[model samples]
Target chain A: MFPTPIARARPSVRTIYMFGLPVSLFIWLIPLLAVMLTSIRSAGDIAAGNYWGWPQGIFLVENYMAVFQNSPIAAFILNSFKVTIPTVIGAVALSCLTGFALGVYRFKANLLIFFMFVAGNFVPFQILMVPVRDLTLKMGMYDTVTGLVLFHIAFQTGFCTLFMRNFIRALPKALIEAARVEGVSELRIFWFIVLPLMRPAIAALAVLIFTFIWNDYFWATVLVQGEHAMPVTAGLYSLNGQWIASWHLVSAGSIVAALPPVAMFFLLQRHFIAGLTLGAVK
Target chain B: MADSIAGKSYWHQNQRRIAPWIFLAPGVFMFAVYVIIPIFQSMEISLYDWDGIGEKTFIGIENYIELLDDEAFYTSLINNLLWLLFYMLAVPAGLFMSLFLNQTVFGIRLVKSLFFFPFVISQVVVGLVFAWFYDPTFGLLALIFKTFGFQPLAVLADERYVTYGIIFAGLWPQTAYCMILYLTGLNAVDPEQIEAGRLDGAKGWRMLWHVVLPQLRPATFIAVVVTVIGALRSFDLVSIMTDGGPYGSSRVLAYYMYEQALSEYGFRMGYGAAIAVVLFVIMMVYISGFLWSMYRQEREGR
Candidate 1:
């Protein structure tokens, strides 16, 4: 509504606008389109310098199948799911409690603790990498899915708490006050009242954490050296090394690696948007 | 019965004071151990000489002194500054895209989603895609340049263009991300305000600047914050695309620190930690400002 709507514009302008949309979209997605095309393209096409031309043949099934069968991509994909699911559950659940405390409580330490989480969320990973790895090694959890999962849950808690606290704070304060007046125990109020209303926040945070932990390459590389626990993002990097000169295979692997999060994004787009745009409006 | 009543009364009296901590304890414990403690540890490690498996020998500020004379450090620092500057362009580009696609038209949902597709994918994938797109021998860019009877530059291979090339790939997803934020913000803008502007005879760029852009401040703030953070956290693309290639022209502090601490560069843990500390200090300056402003807002909003 900010720009005068195209419906109110002249017919010629509207026609031009309609025509420009797809062309612009096409240009915008050219890199993705090229990769997608290459994924379905045969090795022969790649070898023959046919990156742009119509594929000499289609190898979508073979190439995609090879990504799973000929590599540890299946195991890597499983590893990602293994790490991501637990982190989502743990981070979101933990943040719910923390968010509740920070949002509802009027205490001396409330804002300080909240600010700590907020600040921790922004610290560069370099600052945390060496020590976190050492800590993980000390715990005997290095290079394992559980270790990665735990670190993610803890690290992601910062952002998740920030999100969850803001969301909880925005809820009606009078509701909590009324419950307090009735002598409802603090724990019971959180469980019975606040928890139910936090469904949207939980959904939003879950989707966000799932994508984040899934696509996490930095930790995966630092903590997990072996294919046994490598997430898809890092796994794809290793596969890039193995599949040297095979751009077609690499493209296919990239697509396979990207699919889960992309699907999650599409399926829960509203929640994803809600999570990301949390502070974009009053 | 008398004991139970006493216990209940005591809990009732102390509940307000104890309940929040009871809720906060686990998250606080985990965050402190993994996140908060590490900052100090990184700093501590920076002051000591260690190969990660040995006892640390403290030599205060020695690593920082060496970093002062390291050419690569300065290069990475400068590249980081450039990254910060160029990455800010995503904010305006995103706003423009959001404005362009703000209209309600048929199949717009799918179009918007498609525009946002680059962001959902991993940076590694974005890196690989751009790397291939910029491939000299068999890439689309080279082919286009060939058709135009001009030689294509090997962007990732050339030391001069390597950082910019990686930044370009980095910007694709960043712009898409910022566009999504702005789109969501635009959705919530008040129609009455826009009508008021229109009645005052504002149109075109004048309308956007005075009437609309002011309303989009929250989106802009978030856009700037994320871009700054993303620009600094630019290790993944550097690692994936060029690996600071063509004579280490593309290294940012994050990647450079990784090269020092890890990789085949022979884990100079102390030196790496020093680099990390520098990066941390740079970030702390920004982080403190961000937190202070957010804290002010939280106070004011209440």
Candidate 2:
């Protein structure tokens, strides 16, 4: 929009721009295309020096089924959902209240608390790794889905709070004041009034947190040790070790692992990008 | 239905006394317990010598002294610096990609989303993909090298290139993030300003440099902040790709802390805590800067 369509004749260059789009896209997605092609190739094709050639045999079904049956990939996918869902709910709920309070209250420590959440969100996970893992172990929650969920909830609160606070701050302060004048208790006002207005913010945070916790690898490795609790990210890495020369299976498994978040992104792309680009524009 | 101001003392006292602290409790409590307190705990623990299971022996500053002399620590620190420097390139590259895709061509939305796919997927997968891509025998790079009549370099296995190899994988996702930021920023640019610039015959990179870059400051700042944090906190990719292998050349501070605290080398919890404290201190500088900047912006808005 900002490019100002030069009113003078530039038809040839515009046509060239239109024509060049697809070629550029094709080049951009080369890595993904390679992975897709490799996933359908049979092992025999890979071994037969057919890396980039047309696949002599397509084994998409066989490779996908093999990844599930041969490894604990199904269990891993289930574990990812198990860890992801609860954290999404917990972090969003907590931040809604926190965001509301920070947005609505004119307290002395308001910015102090807000800045704490922002800073905490940016700190490296390593600084918290030793203590968090040890705490989880002491509570007998290590290697459990709940343990991962708890840590994620606590950790994600930082980013969610930042997003939610800014969002609530942008809402019309008049609405809350009008409700307050009608003698609505603050708690009910939050439950019935503010919460209903937060649908967009909630959707954004939910999609973002879902992708984040699902794709998480560090905590999955630190907290969980066995096949039962491993997420796809860790499971895929371990599988890569076992399938030494099985590029076909590896590519299939990678695709399978990547599908959920990719699907989520497409389905909720508006909210997803909205959530990501916070603070990008004035 | 209005509660008149004649008897406002009751409501005023209640609001003043109770509202803020009640609202602040849950968030502040969780943040303090999970984030703030642990920082001090790590600092305190760093003064001791223990393997996590045994009683901590207070050995004042020994870990710090050793870190100053440790070659591995130096290597990890230098690698972190390299990551920070190279990672900043994503900002300009992302801006260029955003400009390329800002047009309204057919299915451009889908194309944009596909370009962003790397950011949504886990870095672990990105690492695995690159590791396979760089495999000396059958990797894409190896295959290309063979076609050119050259020997394949074992990138991950080679000590000199291992850190750089891992950084390349990191840049993939990071660049996607920056592109999205710039795209969003580009969406908000004023059309009239561009029209005025065009009327003045300002075109090409000059128009972009003067008219565009000034408006994109917020986007640039956010991109730089996230990139710096991502580079400094790069642990997962290193862990997944090389596991600090080939003489631990790829050990950034975060991964080094994990290896010391949890791996087969046995838990040097105190030393690990020391390393964590150092990383935290460095990160605090950026965190404080971000906080101060935001605080000033908020005040100015008020």
Candidate 3:
């Protein structure tokens, strides 16, 4: 509207504007498009240096199947799910209680505790790297999916609490007060009255955390060592090292590794955007 | 029966005071252990000399002293500064992009999603894609250079261009992220103000500069915050694309810290902690600023 919408512009300008949209989008997504294209190319095409050209053969199924069958990618994908789902459930459930407390109460340390979570969420991961690794190793959960999942659930709670607290804060306070006046126990109030209203926040946080933990390369590498427990991001990196010349396979693996989160984003675009851009509008 | 009735009354009277703590206990405990305590532990580790699995020898500030003389440390610090500067460009680029796409045109939603595709993908994939894109042989850039009668550039292999090359790759997704933020912010812009600006003969860039951007402060603030954090936390791309290669030209603090403490390099856990502490201190400056702003907002909202 600020640019004086194209509908109000001259025919020539409107035509140019409409034409420009796809052109710009094409240029913007060229890297991904290239990878998507290369992922479907046959090994013959890659060997023949036919990267940008039309693929003489579409080996999409073959290349993807090879990625799963030949490498540990299937296990990695499974590992990603194993880590991500638990972290989502744990972090979301914890944050709901924390958010409800901070939002509904006027305790002395409420803001202090809320800010601690907020601040903890922003600290660089490197600061926690050595200690977290040491802690994981000491717990005998090193190089295991449980170790990775526990750390993620703990670390992600900071961000999720901040999000959930702010969301709960924006809810009307009278409903909570009325519930309290009805002599409902505190836990019951949270379970029945507040938890039902937090579904959107829960969904948003769940999807966001799923994508975050799924694509986490740092923790997967730091806390886990072997192919047995590695998630797809780190697994794909290691695989990329092995398949140096086999660009077709690497591209296919990358796509496969990236698909779940991409799918989640597309399916839950509204909640995803709501979660991510929470502070952008207000 | 008498004792049960007394317990019930006590809980009924004190539930208001106890409920918040009960709700906060689990999250706070986890956060303190995994996030809060580790920060102090890292700071403590930075003061000692250790090999991660062995006893830590207390040699106060020695790691920091060595870091001052380490050339790689200097290089990493400079590269990090460069990253912070260049990554800020995403903010304006995203604003420009959002302005370009802020319309009700046909198929615009899909177009916007396509444009935002990069941010949803992992940084590892983004790095791999850009690494190949910058490949000296049989890469798109090589073909473009050949068309222009110039030599093919091995971007990651050249010390001069390696850091910028990686930063350029990082910018793709970062710009997409900022664009999405701005697009959301644009949706909430008031139309009455725009019409008023038009009545005042402010159109095009004038309208955007004077009328639109002022309303977009929150989006810009969040964009800046995320971009700064993203730039500082740029380990994944550096690791995937170049691995601080071409004589360690692309190492930022985050990557360097990992290299010092982990990887195939000798595990000098103390030195790595020192590097982490430095990065942490730098981040805290920005973190404090962000929290201070949030504090002010909280106060005003109350």
Candidate 4:
């Protein structure tokens, strides 16, 4: 509305504006489009220096199959799921309780605790790197899936709590007050009254956390060592090292590693955007 | 039976006071152990000298002293400064992009999603994509350079261009993120004000500068905050694309810290901790600013 809608503009300007949209989008997504194209290129195509040209032969299925067969990529994808699903459940469940407390209560330390979570969420990951790794090693969970999952759950709780608390704060308070006046226990109030209203927040947080933990490369490298426990991001990096000149396989693996989160985003775009843009408006 | 009834009544009376603590206990415990306590631990670790697996020797401020004379440390610091500066460009770039795509044309929603596709993918993939894009022989840049009768540039292999190359790759997704934020903010803009500005003959850039931007403060603030954090957390791209290579010219503090403590480099845990502490201190400055702003908002809301 601010630029004066094209509908009211001169026919020439409107035509130009409409034509410009796809051109700009094409330029913007060129990198991804290249990779998507490269993933379907046959090894013969790559070897013949046909990097950016139309592929003479499509090997989409073959390249993807080779990625799974020739490497530990399947295990990596499974590992990603194994780590992501638990962290999502643990972090979201914990935040619901924390959010309910901070949002509903008027306790003396309410803001203090809330700010602690907020502040913790923003600290750079490097500061936590050394100690967290050491802690993981000492717990005998080093290079294990449980170790990665636990740390992710703990670290993600900070952001999830901040998100959940702010969401709960915006809800109507009349129902909560009415339920409290009826002598319902606080736990039941949270379980029955509040939790039912929080489905959207839960869904939003779940998808966001799933994407975040799924794409996590840093922790996967730091805490895990072997192919058995490595998630796809780190696994893909290591595989990149091995398949030095095999751009086709690397591109296919990259796409495979990125698929789950991309799928999640398309499936839950509304909740995902709702979660991300929470603070962008008043 | 009377005692049981009394117990139930007492619980009913005190539940309100006790409920918050019960709700907070698990989350607080986990956050403190994994996030809060480690911050202090890293600060303490910075004061010592240790390999990760062995005993730590206390040599106060020695790591910091060494960092002052270390050329790589300075290089990383400068590169980080460059990253912070260049990353701010995403804010305006995103605003421009959002304005360009703010129309209500057909299939606009799909167009917006396609534009936002980069942000949803992992940084590792972005790095890989850009690495190919900057490939000296077969890359798009090479093709463009060839068309113009210039030499192909191996961007990641040149020390001067490596950091900038990686930063440009980082900007792709970051700009997308900011664009999405602005698009959402644009949705909530008051149409009445835009109409009023049009009536006042404030059209195009004038309307944007005078009327639209003031309403976009929240979006701008969020965009700035996330971009700063994104710039600082630029380890993934550096790791994947260059590995702080071409004679370590592209190393930022985050990547350098990892190199010092982990990787195939000798595990100087204490030195790594020192580097992390420096990055942490820098981040804390912004963190405190953000928290202070939030505090003021809370007070006003109350």
- Using lDDT, give the best candidate's number: 3
TM-score of chain B of each: 0.98, 0.95, 0.98, 0.98
Residue-level lDDT of model 1, residues B145-212, one tens digit each, is 99999998799999888888888899999999999999988988889989988999989999899888
Candidate 4, residues B1-302, lDDT tens digits: the string is 99998999788888899999999999999999999999999999999999988799999999999999999999999999999999999999999999988888899898898898898999989999999999999999999999999999999999989999999999999999999999999999999999999899998889999999999989999999999998888899999999999899999999999999997889998999999999999998998999999999999988
DockQ of 2: 0.64
TM-score, model 3, chain B versus true chain B: 0.98
To one decimal, what is the Cα RMSD in angstroms of model 4 from the true structure? 1.0
| Candidate 4 local lDDT, A1-282, one digit each (tens) | 766777888999999988888898889888988898999999888889899889888888999999999999999999999999999999999999999999999999999999999988988899999999999999999999999999999999999999999999999999998988887889998999999999999999998999899989999999999999999999999999999989999999999999999999999999988888879988
Off by over 4 Å in 1: B1-3
Per-residue error for A252 in candidate 2, Å, reads 1.2
What TM-score would you give candidate 1 relative to the actual structure? 0.99
Candidate 1: clashing pairs of residues: none
lDDT on C-alpha atoms for all candidate structures: 0.92, 0.88, 0.94, 0.93
Comparing candidate 2 with candidate 4, which one achieves the higher TM-score?
4
DockQ category of candidate 4: high
Which ranges of candidate 3 are over 4 A from the true structure?
B1-5
Q: Taking the tens digit of each residue's C-alpha lDDT, what string does model 2 give over B1-302?
A: 25666367566557634665776677677777777777777888889998877798999999999999989888889988999999898999899999888877667899899899889988877888888788898788898899999999899999999998999888888999999999999999998899899899998799999999999999999999999999899998999889998899999999898898889988998889888888888888888889998999999978
TM-score of 4: 0.99
Clash count for each candidate, listed in order shown = 0, 0, 0, 0
